[model samples]
Target: MKAKLTDAFVKNITPPASGRLDIVDETTPGLVLRVMASGVKSWSIRYRPKGRKQLRESYGTYPSTSLSDARARAKALTAAASVGRDLVSEEAAAAAAKAEEEAKAKTIADVVADYIKAHVAKTRKAGVTEKLFANHIVPVLGKKTVGELRRADVVELLDSLKNKGWRTNAQVNRVHAALKACLNWAVEREYLDANPAAVVKKQVTERPRDRVLSDGELKAIWEATDVRTDPSRAFIRLLILTGARRDEIRCMTWSEIDLEKGIWTLPKARNKGHRDHVVPLSNEVKAILEALPRLGECVITTDGKIPYAGQKSLKESLDKAVGASNWEHWTLHDFRRTVTTGMSALGVREEHRERALNHAVGGIGNKVYDRHAYLDEKRAALQAWADRVMLIVDTSGPQNVVAFEAS
Candidate 1:
């Protein structure tokens, strides 16, 4: 059937018995309306260039591509066909190129995922790297394609983290390094031309932290711990008493502990040093462990299956208990620092303090040949530190201080 195409005419048209119903517009030659047997309707242009085969190019679906729209598109295709241009093949080629581009494009989040799977997952620092991405990078630049990320975006993220007091300069730098490594990997893999993070300068120069808690602050924190519930108080006190890393305490397991031998043997896989470390359990640490319920695998667990992960809330409660004004910018890791410094002040040996902190002391002799576990020295240092911490918390002065032989 042939007629001037109209909305009413198209709507009234019905599907044929077995094949499609074709309605050609008198206004635009070769412009056709197709109604499928399934009742689907679409507008298309059928054209043959002067020297080429017949071809069809769909304008769009029925109501979406209205009568006017179909006629205008058909007129353009008819004129192009007369000039010897195959519009259908040109559109198809352009579509193929676009699809190829889309297939190859990788977003920042995609690159980050690849970087973690291909590289960070193999390292001992995988957990730290993952936290860096989750807490900092992904929220800002994850959706942007790798090729489109700019140095300004990198700088802005770091600035936001610092300006908002979300993380320290050192922490922001660690995040920056993670981003740089990820972008560099993308470049190496030809996913990106260059690393935008590589050129971005650190917003603040990272000075090594020497922020040890003062005696008064320690006393306040100790007093504060008393107000918190089971696992939190135990967790904070262990960080102070044993001088172990925060994650080590959080992920501490019953299987790693030997109550009979008074040892917490951390496996090589979990330790930052990538070597098995034996932490001597002092009387103070032992008491804390003994008092804890035998929660499935983790010692300091609330659910009995997995370890406690809500440190942010714990810290908030602690700050409230301690009176936030009393302490200045202290973190859980700082408790480890406070313990080490207190040991030094108590006349503990340098080697003994390093060993207690599980630091891999430099030098080939120290790394390769130091088979001495220094169990006795560590035990003594921890005991002294615990005694000092107890005295600070006691607030009763002379009577509460326990005497211990300095290592």
Candidate 2:
């Protein structure tokens, strides 16, 4: 064993190597030092624990980790390990040592990119996930690396979302989901020891989806659609009647609709889930489509032109409709509920209801062949929903709940 000396005496002694090569300090067994050569000046504690083989722990690079501090840390760990602390405990001790500055080593931007490229892109539609990350996650956290990010950094970003309201919160929540997904990947890749974002919670500032519309609200939409000469009114009303996704509606073309067949075919590419779908249309929907001024290839046209471009076109018109009404806190999407709720009240079969809305549940293959040959029953249910919606719009009444014996 090397002779033990006080801290001052150990600090004074310089090894044979040049000034760059350092004698870090004494450890649990003996004096520890390093000889610098390449860009990395690594430290080694050449000592043995009690009843153990000799081994050296490479602490870190030099100048970056000062010789004095490195020696002091090595001595503490070696002392702990010598006292019979297990491997797991030693690892925990090592992690605690590295947590502070090293955690900050990864920037948000770098980790986000890696996580997207490595994991998220593979599972989700690359374009959709890319659009989401680019629009929301990267703007605030892009510059920072994985290690540098902390809980407060995430919290601060979340707090900024409060000003923009629910839609913004939707974006924020998605950003967090993307970040959590990416950071977990970092941990798996050994880029990080643990994911700091796993525990973060999304604050619920907005009310839960109570999307069922009210009596007066129904009346306003009805009056607007009924009296307005424009066919787009009927299209918006059908959106409420059908309960399909807005994108599904926006991209609808004439080829997809069969007036005689009484069905609308939504191609897989246009669906949010990227699956081919068919919507069971109501007579009210049929009447509306029949009345619309067809523009080009789309159904919702005025003078042979697609009304505006996408949902933005539809939303802009709806926004104008909303401005004309005496309303508070309602949107076009509430129609999906309008159909689902209206049907259940009118004794519609659950399977028929789900199918009518083109909701793909029970996986892709099951959805493909789960046809009931009950198109008449489904048409009746959809028509019932449309009737109820019209009744509410016509009379400004609430849900006309007509209970039936359970099937």
**Model 1 — TM-score against the truth?**
0.69
Per-residue lDDT over 362-404 for candidate 2, one digit per residue giving the tens place of the 0 to 100 score = 7776757765555676677777777777777665556453444
- For each candidate, how many residue pairs have backbone atoms clashing (under 3 Å)? 0, 15
Error of 1 at 188 (Å): 2.8
Put down candidate 1 lDDT per residue, 1-407, tens digits, no spaces.
88887789898887887788888888789899989998889988889887988888878998887888888888878788999997777888999777556634778888889899999999877877998998789989889887578889999898888887754567778888899998888778767667788988876786777789988888887788877777888998898888898889998999999999999999988888888999999888999999999968989889779878889998888888778765577788888888889988888888888998899788999989979889998888888888888777785656333343454
- lDDT of prediction 2: 0.66
Best by lDDT: 1
Whole-model Cα lDDT per candidate? 0.84, 0.66
**TM-score to native of every candidate shown:** 0.69, 0.57
